[model samples]
Structures are given as structure tokens and as C-alpha cells.
Target: MSLQIYDTKIGKKIPFTPLRDNHVRIYACGITAYDFCHLGHARSALVFDMIVSYLRHSGYKVTFVRNFTDIDDKIINRAQKQNTTCAELSQRFIDEFYIDMKALKITPPDYEPRATEHIPEIIDIIEKLMTKGIAYQADGDVYFEVEKFPQYGSLSGRNLDDLKAGARISINKIKKNPMDFALWKASKPGEPKWDSPWGEGRPGWHIECSAMSRKYLGDSFDIHGGGEDLVFPHHENELAQSEGASGKPFANHWIHHAFVTIRDEKMSKSLHNFLTIREVLKRHQPEALRMMVFATHYRHPLDFSESGLRDAQTSVNRLYNCMAACAALTDGTESSKAVATRAEIDKLRSLPDRFQEAMDNDFNTAQGLGCLFDAVKSINRISQALPAPPAQADINLLRRGGADVTKLAQIMGLLSQEPQAYLAGYQEKHLTAVGMDKAELNKLLEERIAARQNKEWGRADEIRDLLLAKNIELKDSQDGTAWYVAGDRGQ
Candidate 1:
């Protein structure tokens, strides 16, 4: 079946036909890098991550681009508050962004361009808009004239009159209408500045994505995604500027993930309700966070609550427990693996169909997760009946199941760590004390084989306990036992 995705512009599910065959290009509006990453940012990251993961798993070459708005009001103000340059401050947050994404297991985008890094691209786009008469210079600032673009509100479904009414116009004497947004902002003293036809200034938030998307992807791309809050003014203006400048459809599909609310209220740093990934990881496993985020559909609002997380934790634990039991089971007959293999294959084959179905319908993550949970159950059941170390056939099935889980989880930025590591409170010291490091743990585990083969159950159990005490957990397979360190398992 064709991969179907909901097109935000048309508000319907449509087959994804890439501009180029066997290839997909995606653009996700990345964070502004002004503050610590928040749940809202996580949602956007995960949303597109899933899209890319599924596309690749489905055998398409995916070029994913997620940009950083390294220059913005918040970034400038933050730098000033910290008594630093905008570039310095942005660099700090960029580092933090990577750390947070890594902790959440979010795959790095194929191209992670920064807005400040793409100044030339932004200038070229502004030049195009100027030549097309879609944008004009006003008081040394380039602004896209709202009225000049006939399809100005087509994406957001609001006309110029309604937009003018709803928009909050500051005391800007040069703007012809309140709805007119900036393509470029004139630089202020002490702020980051770039040389442009409009003087030393920076590109506006909307223009950066359009410019970066065009530079890295093309005049048109397959999907452009961001948070729902960006639907207006941000994403809306991106459409106006990109299509208006290029005179081509900017993107074939637009996907927006919903916001995250805390305690049934809007989450704001001012409200002190903003939940950072670091903060969340303090109390829950990364996989738990993944499950929590995916419990609801990407296009729907997700409420943040302690109770909700507890539920997710419970669910992930159940899956792990089932897998552990499967690993522990020992069936005498070799044919046991073959029987388990057939069952596992059936389950694996069914995964893509259901997962795709959910993703096709507006990126319905909730439904996709439902399908994933079903697959997890099937895997656990097959494991229960498999031979010890699982028949070579069963071992293959286990690997496939692991891949299925890992693939879906990668899209959600979850489960990148070894399962055992995730369950143990792994630390660097413990990793080193294991007489091995992450890179060497697999080989060192071979030494333990002799003890187990010698039927030194007492010695083998001691080694396992020692590893566990050091925040490393082991999973014994027919081949051998492997270990992982759990990063965030308890609060």
C-alpha cells in the first residue's frame, strides 16, 4: 500500500509521492535554541523522526532537514541577560539541544542547518520576493506585503481582512497592514547582525525555514512539520514567503504536532510548568517518556500529568518483563524455535501495515502506538514458547521484534539504548568498573561463558549480581549474556 499522510493544507490523507522516486525530502522547523528544550520541542522532533524512520524502513532514501533558529528575539535577549554574544548563547543552547535529543534518543537529522549559517540563502529568498514584488523594503526592514500575495491566507484559511483584524500590530509606521509580517528585521545595536540589502539585520523566523528548506531540500519538498503553535504567523508566513518568492508550491504536505499542556493548563516557563527533557528523565525511563508521548496522537494535544507517566511506566515495564520471561524459557526441542519463528514473522509482517495506517491518517501516533503495543504483545507471546537461547530461528525472530520496536521507538526518539542499560541506572564509573567499556562489553561477556558452561551457577549468579549492582543488567541469550546500563529508570 502507498504511504499515506495527512496534508495539513488540504486536511486529508493523501498518498506521499516524492518529487523524486524512491527518495523523500522532509523539513521540520527546529527549536529557536534560546532556552532548555521543552516537551513541545520534543513532540516536533519525535513527530518528524517517526516520519523519517518509517520512510527509511519502507525502503525510501530520506533526506531529513531540521534547522535551528539560532538568531531570534529570545536568543538575543538571553545572550544579553547572560552578558554574552548571541552566537555564544546560541552555541550553548545548541549544545544543550543535542544533549537533550541524545538523552531522548532522537536521531540526528540528516542536515541540521542553523538560520545564522544560512544567511546567504535567506538573502537570496528576500531578493526573489523583491523582484517578484511580493515583498518590499520599509524603514530598512524587508516586509512581505500581506495584500500583495493573493493566496496570503490560503494555508491558514484566513483572508487578509480577518488577519488584519486578528493580528496585533505594534506601533510600526512603515507597515501597510497589521497582518504584514517581516521577511527581515533591521538590526538593533548590540544584536547579531548580517549585511543585507536591508542593512545589518537578521532574517525573520518564518523566512529562515523557507530559505533553509529551499537551500537544502528544494523549491518544493515532501513534508514540512512543526508544532501546532507555529500554524499561524510562523508556518502561515513560511507558505506566503516561499511560494510567493519561488512561484512554486513550497511543499506537498504540511504536518503539525500538537502542543503539550501541563496539569490541564498551558505549559509556559513563566508559569514554571515547562517540563524539560532533562527534568523528565530525572524521574522516568526514556522509553517511558516515549510511550507517554506516543500514547496520544501527534496531531492531538497531550496533557502532562504524573499519573499519566506512571501509566506509561507500567506499560513499558510489562513489555520488558514479558521479554525477560521469554529469554528465561527453555524448550527442549529445536523445532520449538521454528514454530516460534512463524508466529513472530506473522507479527512482524503485520506491523508495517498497521503502523502505516496510523501514520497515514494525520500521523495518528496514538493509533500507531496501539498497533505497536499489539506487536509487542505478539512478540512476548512468541518468546514464551520459544526454545532456550531461542532456536536459531527464534533468535532471528527476536532480532526482528527488537528491530520493529527500535524502528518505531527511534521515530519517537525512544529506546535507542540497549534494553538492559535502560533498565539499570548506568553510570560511567559503573560502565568502567565492569572490567569493560560500552565498546568492549560484548567481548568481555565472552569470559562469563566459561563459568556458565562449567555449571558454576553460583559464580555466574555472582557475576550477574555484581553487574546489576553496578547499574548494569544482563540478558542471557542462547548465544550468551549481554549487559546494559539503565540511565533513567526511577525518579
Candidate 2:
């Protein structure tokens, strides 16, 4: 089957053909790194991550480059508050970002170039724009000449004349047109500055991405993605800057993920309604978070709520149990379930094909996941038969089906963790947060251990019930006993 994706540029779904044979180059706008990442950031990353994953699964060699805007105004402002250099503050968040990404199971991009590390590349692009008369300098600042780029509003489908009338203009003396955006801003006192032909100033927010993307992915790339909020000024300006400088199309496909809202309102720090990734992960399993993202299409708004997460958690738990049950059913048991027959296994093998069909239709993750849930439901029923220790063929069917879910989940950077480990961490974090004394809990657990060792199942069950009353959970794996407290709390 041929791969197809919805191209925002064409406003339609089309067969996906790589610029090069069996190769794909994708550029996703990364975080500014001024503070902790939020759910919105996670969504954008995961959305493109899925694109990259599916492309690879379809046999394309993908070069994924996600840049870091480490030299933005926000980083400088944050540095001032911390009484540190912008480089120091940006690096701190960059380091923290990877930690959160790991916890969320989001894969790192193939290339993560930082803006500060690529000043020369940014300056070269700006110089090219200047020589081309697409950009001009004024009072040590350089701004893109919107008039030179006649197609400036085409990507966004907005008329500049209308935008100028309705939009509030910035009070910058250097701007020749109300719509012309800055390519570079002159340095301020005590702020980070880089030497450029134009003057000692840093790259503007949008230019860094254009320069970095071009520097890594070349003049034109397969796909460019970011939050839908960036579709207007940010990505629109990027198209102008990169294409204007290179005289080539910026990206063949433009992908944008919709905003993550809280109670129908946008999640923003200014609005005081955003939940940091660290805070949210502190409460829920990362896979559950990823599932929440997968529940909605990339182009649709997702509203965050406790009930939604609860539903996601329940769904994840059920999936985990199904996978576990499949793992447990060994070769031919006394109670061989009819659902694990040769005919049934063959039916299960067709799931990946169905999953690919859903993904081929514009990366429809919701539909793809529905296929996954259907497979998981079927497997749960089959595993009950406990077929004489399931044969390699049977296990292979389960593995293939489970791997499909795992692969899709990973593409979205969700549910890629060992199910037991995630459950353990989820329980431990919640228990520890609820003001439980570990030493006291351990003493009670030790008593239960002695009873279980003496084959006193009743006493062990009784002791376990007492801990359950305190909202503590115990899981008995082959290794030993582990306990955790439970609650919906934030870090």
C-alpha cells in the first residue's frame, strides 16, 4: 500500500513521495528552553515524532532535525531574573528537557542544534537576505521586507493588508512595514550578543529555525511542523525568511498540531492555567499522558482534565493487563481456549495491515489506536484459552500485534515503558506524595512478608487489606514485594 498524508500546503491528502528515494528529511520547531516544557510542547513533539516513526516504518530513511531556540528573548529575560547568563539558563532547561522527554518516552531527534551554537549560519542567511534586498537594516536592527516577499501571507492564507488593519502594530522604529517582522534585534545592556555584519545582536525568534533548518536539512525539506499557534506569525515568517533567502520552496509539507487546552481555554503561563510536563508526569504515568494525546487527532484541540486522565489510565491499565495475560498463557494448558486457534492467529496477523491503512490516511492516530484497542480486545479473549503453552507461531502473533501498539505509542512518545516499571513508579510517586511514612509502611509490609513465608495466606491477605485501607498498593512480582501510596497529586 502507498503512503499518503494530508499536505496543509495543498489543503488535501496526497500520496507521499520523498524528495529522494526511500529518504525523508523532517524539521520540527523545538522548545525555547526558557522554562520547563508543558503538555503543549509534548503534543507538538509527539505529533511529529509519529510522522517520523511512520515514515521509517514504511521503509524511509529519515533525517529528523529539531532545533532549540536557546537564544531567544525569553531565555534572556529568565537569565536576568536568575542573575545568570542566558547560556547558563538555556542549558539548564535543555538538560531538564531531555529528562522530561525520557520520562515521557519521547525519542530525541536525530539532530538537536541550538541557535547560539549556530550564529554564523544565522548571520550568513541574514546576509544573503540583505544582499537579495529581501531584508534591510535600520538602527542596528534588521527586519524582513514583507513587500519583497509577495507570497508572505500565502502560507497562512491571510491578507497582509487586512492583518495590518486589525493587528496591533509593534512600536519598533526600524520596522518599515507594520507587517514586516524582525530578523535580528540589536543587543541590550547585559544581554547575550553576537557579532554580525549588521551589528552586535542576536537572531530573532523565527530566523533561528529557518537558519538551523536550512543548515541541517538543506534548502528544502520534506516536512516542517510546530504548534498550530505558530502557523500564523512564526511559521509564516519562517517560510518568508528561508524561501526568500534560498529561492527554493521551504518545505514540501507543513504539519501543525493543535493547542492543548484546559477546560476549553488555552494553556498558557500568562493565563495561569498551564501544567508543566514535570508536574503532570509527577501525577500520572507517562504512557497515560501519551494515550491522552493519542485520543485526539493532531489537528484538533485536546482539553486536559482529571477525568480524561482517569479514563486514559484505565485504558492503559487494561492494555497492560492484556499484554500480561498474553505473555502468561504458555503452550497447551488443560483449558485450551478456542480463541487461540490457527484461524484466529491468522486473523490477528492482519491487524498491522489495518493499522497501516489508518495511518496512511493522513496519520489518523485515533483510528490507528482504535485498531490497536480492537487487537488488544481480541488478544485478551484468546489468551484465556491458555493454548498448550502458546506455540512460537501463536506468540509471534501476539508479539506482532503488541509491537504494533508499542511502535505507534512510541511514535507518539507514549506507553513505551515497561508496564510493570511504570506502574511501580506511578504507585511509588503517588504514595510518597501523600505524606506516607516509608519506614512505618515497610514495618507493616515486613509483617505481611513473614506471614506469606509461613504460608499464612489469610494473615497476609488481612495485612494487605490494612494497607489498602490506607490507600497503599502492593504488587508481588517474582522478585519480591513493592508498595506505593496512591493519589492524584502534582509535583
Candidate 3:
């Protein structure tokens, strides 16, 4: 089946056809690099990451570009406050952004261009717009004449008269139109600037993406995407600047992911409720955060909550637990990996097709996760149904089952860790959140082991109940007592 995605420009779900056969080029708007990265940033990064992952998994060669807004008004203001240069401040945060992304296990973009690095490209676009009469200079500042481009509001769905009525005051008094936005801003005292034909100034917000994308992905690319908040002024203005300069389509399709909200309100640092990736990682594994994102469809708003995040941690625990079980069931021997029977592993064999069906529909990770958990359930059932000294054929089937489930999960950037290692990390984080340490857990387990050895059943049960109250679960087998914080375990 062909891939389908919702195009924000056309405002409909359409069959995705790349401009080049078997190749896809995409550019996603990246961070402003003026502050620490938050969940809002995480959501956008993961959304695009999943899209790229699925595209490559489907055998398409993908070139992904996510840019950095290294030169901006925000960067200038923040630099003056911190007593640093715009270049230093912006690059500092750019490094911090990469740290956060690495902790989140985000795939590094193929090309990470910065506005400051592409000054020449920015100037070239502005010169083209100026020569074509699409943009004009007024008192050292250059503004795009919205009235000059007939398709100015096509992407944003705004009209001239309504927009004029909505804005009673023009941001720049000398501009020809109220809705006209800046292409180049004249330099201010102590602000970073590059010498240009328009005088000493920097590129405007919208113009940066146009120049960076054109330089990296050409005048027209297969896809352009970002957070929904950029649609109105940022993307709309970018669309105008690129097409107005090149006289061609800016992007073949546009993909916009919805906002991440907290308590039904949008997540933002200004609202004072934003949680940074660093803060979240201090209490939860990175894979847990990735799962929390995949739990919701990209086009839908993800209502953030502490409880919801904990649930995602629990879900990760279950996935890794299932992996551990499958491995334990089958000894890693050549005979154990041989094909058992077609009927024995039929459900396991159906993963790729089942997963592709969900993802092919606008990258529906939530539905793809549903398929994932169903396979998890199937393997778990197989593990439970095995006899004490399992037959060779069943071992082979279990080995195949474990490998198949892992392959599918890895596509969505989950279950990439060794099962034991993942479970240890997941348990440690939960342990820290609950104000307990693994040292304490080990001590308690030691005491319980003594109680069980003495055959003091009541004392042993009391210790188990005490740990259970702390959300730590336990299992008993011939190997003795084994426990991890596997969540509430259905109470």
C-alpha cells in the first residue's frame, strides 16, 4: 500500500507521492536556540523522527534537514541579558539542544544548518525578492509586500481585508501593508549583523527557513513540516518568500503536528508549566518519554500529566519484560533458532505487514503501538504456555518471536536496549521518583530472603506487601526471589 499523510497546505489527507522516485527530501523547522529544550520541542522532534523512520523503514532513501535559528531577536535579547555575544549565546543553547535530543535518542538530522552559517544564502533570496518587486526596502528595513504576492495567504487561509481589520496597528509604520512581514531587519546597537546590500542587518524569521531550505534541499522539496504554531506567520511567510523568490512551488506537501498541552492548555515556558527534557529524564528513562509520545497520534493534542508519564514508564517496563521472558524461554542455540512450524509462529510473522498498515496511514504510531502490544501479548501467552523443559520446536518459535517483536518495536525507537539493562534503568528511575534507592530495595530483599528461608510465611508475605505498596513487584522461581519496579502490576 502507498503511504498517506495529511497535507496542511491542501488541508486534507492525501496520498504521499515524492517528487523523485524512491527518494524523499524533507526540511523541518527546528529550535530557536535561546533557551533549554522542553516537551514542546521533544514532541515536534519525535513526530518528525517517526515520519522519517517509517519512510526509511519502507525502503525509501530519505534526506532530512532540521535547521537551527541561531540569529534572532530572542537570541539578541537573551545575549545582552547574559552578557554574551549572540553567536556565543545561540551556539551554547544549540549545544544544549543536541544534548537533550541525544538523551531522547532523536536521530540527528542529515544536515543541521544554522541561520548565521547561511548568511549569503539569506542575502541571495532577499536580492531575488527585491529585483522581482516582491519585497521593498523602507528606511533600512526590508519587508515583503504581502499585496505583491497574489497567493500570500493561500497556505495560512487568511485574506487581506480580514487580516487588516484584525490588526489595528502596523508593527512597522513604514510598511506598505499591515500584514507585511520583515525580510531583513536593520541592525541595532550591540546586535549581531552582517553587511548586506540592504545595510547592516540580519535575516527575518521566515526568510531564514526559506534560505536554509533552498540551499540544502533546493527550491522545491518533497516535504516541509513543523509545529502547528508556525503555520500562520512563520510558515505562511516562508511559503511566500521561497516561492516569491524562485517562482516555483516551495514544498510539495506540508505536515504540521499539533501542540502538546498541560491541563488542556498549551505547553509553553511563558505559562510557567513547561518541563524540560532534562527534568523529565531525571525521573524516567528516555524510552519512556518516546513511548509517551507514540501513545498519542501526532495530529492529536497530547495532554501532559505526571500520571500519564508514569503509565508510559510502566508500559516500557512491560515491553522489556516480555523481551526478557522470550529470551529466557529459548536458549540462544542454532537448533533453538531453527524454524519450528509455520502455524506455530504465524502471528509473529505478520508483524511487518500489520505494522506497515497502521504507519502507512499518516504515520499512525498509536495504532502501530496497538499492533505492537498485541504481539507482545501473543509472545507472553506463548511463554506462559510452555512446559517446564520445553521442546526444541517451541524454543525455536520463541526465539523467532522475540526477534520479530524487537525488530518492529525498534522502528518506532523503542526496545533498543538489552532487556536486563533496560529493566534496571527503568526500575532505578522509578525508584528515585518514589524517594527510594536500589540500595534500600536490596536491603529489604535481603531481609525477605532471610524470612523466606526461615519458612516464616507471614513475615515473608508482609515484606512482599510492603514492597508492593511502593509499586515494586516481585517474582519467585527456582532461581530464587527476583523483583523490579514493574509498576503497580494491576494492583
Candidate 4:
């Protein structure tokens, strides 16, 4: 099936056809780079990352561009508070952003342009707007005249009258209309400054995206995306500036992911409820958080909570466990009866299509993950039923199924770690949570293995029961005895 994405501008799902055949250009608004990234940032990054991954997986040559607003008011304010330059502060946070993104296993964009690096491009766009009479300079500040652009609110679905009624423009007496947004702001004594036709000032938030996106993705791109919070004045004003200056549509598809909320309220610094990616990763595996993000539809609101994360962790652990079991069964000898039927092999091969189907329907990651979980269940079932010296054909089937599961999981950025490594990490986390010393538990397990080797069955059973009393369950396999927290069969 062809891809169909939900277009925020049209308020409906539309078939995704790139301007050029077999190639897609995407521009997603990146962070302001004033502080550490929060869960909201992580969601936005992962949503686009999945989109790009699926696009490439579907055979499209995708050029993804995500820009950073490194010279914003927030950066300046933060720099002042931290006793540093805006450049230094933004660079620090940008470095931290990369670290967090790497920890979450997010792929880097093809081009990560910084707003401060494109000063000339920003000035050029503002100059074009000025020449077209869509922008005016008042006391060294350049503002896009919202009344001049007929389609000013088209992208946001707000008419001029409605926008004016609810406008929250700065109280600068120099503006013509209350809704006129700044394309360039006059620099103060200590703020970042650039030489522009309008004067020494930096580009506004909206203009930076317009200028940078156009510079990389051209006058029009396949998709332009950001959070739902940007739908209002930010994107609305960006559309006005870019289209009004170029006399063309800015982007074919406008994709906006819904917000990440906490306790039914939007997660924000002002609410004092924002959770940073670093802090969350400190407590849970990065893939667990990614699972939590993907478990919901991209356009739906995701309420961040501890319970949600635990559930996601459990789900991820199940997939890893299934993978591990399949790996174990792959070593068994094959028998003719163990050779999967043609129909069975076909069904296993069709798993990728099922996963693609879910993803194609507007990047429905939740449904895609459901398909993956189904595969996990099937693989686990097959592994559990394997004979004691499994047939070579059945071993091949199990190996193929494991490979298929890993490949499909990669498309969604899950199950990247080695199965044994992931399981060991899960066990470690469980031990830490239960206040059990991992070294002590391992020493006891060693003692039990020694006792069993010496034919001391009673002593080995006593050691097992002692561990069981502490909520630990031990499973003995051909390799060795493994222990995990009780009731966590997935681990």
C-alpha cells in the first residue's frame, strides 16, 4: 500500500507522493537548544525518525533536515543566567541533545543546520519579503505584515479575523497590526547580533525555520513537521513568510505530532513537570522509553507516567526474551517433521508486510508494534514447542523467525541490543529494584551449581528456595542457571 499521512493543514489523511518520484525531502523543526531535551522533544524526534526510517525501508531516497534555533531569546536568556555567550550555551545544549538522542537510539538527520550558521540565508528571505511589500521595518525591527498575506492563516486554519481576535502580539507600538509577527528582531546591547539590511538584529523564531528549511529542502518540500504546539502563530507565521516571499507553497504535507502530557496537562517548564531524556534514561532503558513513545499513535496525546514506562519496559523485555529463546532453539538438529510447511514459511515471511501495513497507515506505530508483538508471541510459541534436540529444519525456521523479528523491530528502532545483553541488563535492573546484591546472588548461584555437580541435591534445592524467598526465580537451561525477578517471565 502507498503511504498515507495525516496532513495537519487539510485536516485529513492524504496519499504521500513526493514531488520527485522515488525521493522525499523532509524538514522537521528541531529544538531551541537552550537546555536539556525533555520527553516532548524525544517524542517529536522519534516520530520523524520513524517516518524517515519507514520511508527508506520502503525504497525512497529520503533527505531529512532538522534545524536548531541556536540564537533565540531563550538561549540568550539562558546564556546570561549561566554567565556565558549564547554560542557557548547553545553549543553545550546541542552536544547534550546529541548525547540524549544517541542514548535513545535516534538516527541523526542528513543535515542538522543551526540557525546561527545561516544568517545570510535568513537575511535574504527577510529581504525578499521586504521587497515584496509583505514585510515592513519599524525602528530596526522587521515584522511580516499579516494583513498583506492573504493566506496568512491558511496552514493553521485560522482566518485573519479570528487570529486578530486571539492574537498575543508583543506590545510594540511600531507594528501595523496586532498579528504582525517579527521576521527580524532588533538586538539589544548584550544579545546576539547579525548584520542585516534591517539593521543589527537576529532572525525571529519563525523566520529561522523558513529560511533554513528553504535553504536545505528548497522552496517546497515533501513534509514539514513539528509538535502540535507549533500550529499556531509559529507555523502560521512561517507559512506566511515563506509562501508570501516565494509565491509558492512551503510544504506539501504538514505533519504535527500531538503533545506529551503529564496528569492531563501539557509538559512544560512553567508547569514544573517536564521530564528530561537524561533523567528518564537514568531510571529505565532507552528502548523502554522509545517503546512508550511508539506505543501510542503519533497524532494522539501520550500521558507520561511511571506505570506507562513500566508497561513499555515489560513489552520490550518480552520481545528480547522471545528473541533469546529463538536463538537457543537455532542450535538443535533438524528433522523432516520439524521443517516448517510452505504455508507456515509464507506466514512467517508475511510478517514484514503486516508491519509495513500498520506503518503505512499514517505512521501508526502503535499498530505496527502490535504486529511486532504478535510475531514475538508466535516465535515464543515455536521456541517453547521445539523438541529436545530440535530438527535442523526447525532450527532454520527458528533462526529465520528470529532474524525477521529483529529486522522488523529495527524499522521501529527497537530490539537493537543483543538478546543476552538486554536480558542481563533487565536482570540487573530487577535485582537493583529488589535491593538484592547482584554479586551475592551470583555467588549463591555458583554455590548451587557446585552443590548439584557434587550430587548434593538437597543443598542445591535449599539454595534455590532461599533465592525464591527473595522474589527471584531460577531457570536452569543447557547453558547454565539464569535468575530473574519473580513474575517477570519476559526477563
lDDT scores in order: 0.78, 0.81, 0.87, 0.87
Query: What is the C-alpha lDDT profile of model 2 across 149-199, one tens digit per residue?
Result: 999887778888889888787676658888888899999888889899977
Model 1 residue runs over 4 Å out of place are 329-352, 375-491
Q: What is the lDDT of candidate 1?
A: 0.78
TM-scores for all predictions: 0.79, 0.86, 0.92, 0.93
Q: State the TM-score for model 1.
A: 0.79
Candidate 2's displacement at residue 331, Å, is 1.7
lDDT of each residue in 209-269, candidate 4, tens digit only: 9998999889988999999999987888888899998998889999999999999899988
Error of 1 at 155 (Å): 1.0
Report residue 82 deviation for candidate 1 (angstroms).
2.4
> Scored by Cα lDDT, where does model 4 land?
0.87
Model 1: how far residue 352 lies from native, Å: 4.6
lDDT of 2 at 56: 82
Query: Model 1 clash tally?
Result: 5
Model 3, range 1-491, lDDT digits (tens) per residue? 88999999888889998898889999999999999999999999999898998899899999999999998888899999999998888889999999999998889999999999999999999999999999999988999999999998888788888788788664767988888888999999888889999899988888989998999899999999999999988999999999999999999999999988999999998899898989988866788888999989998999987788889978887899899887667453333334334544776778778889999999999999998887787777767776555667667666776887788788778998999877777677678777888789889888888888899989989989998888778888767788876454343
Error of 2 at 243 (Å): 1.1
Tens digits of lDDT, candidate 1, 357-449: 777665667787777777777777666665444466665666566577667756665555555544454345456554656666555466567
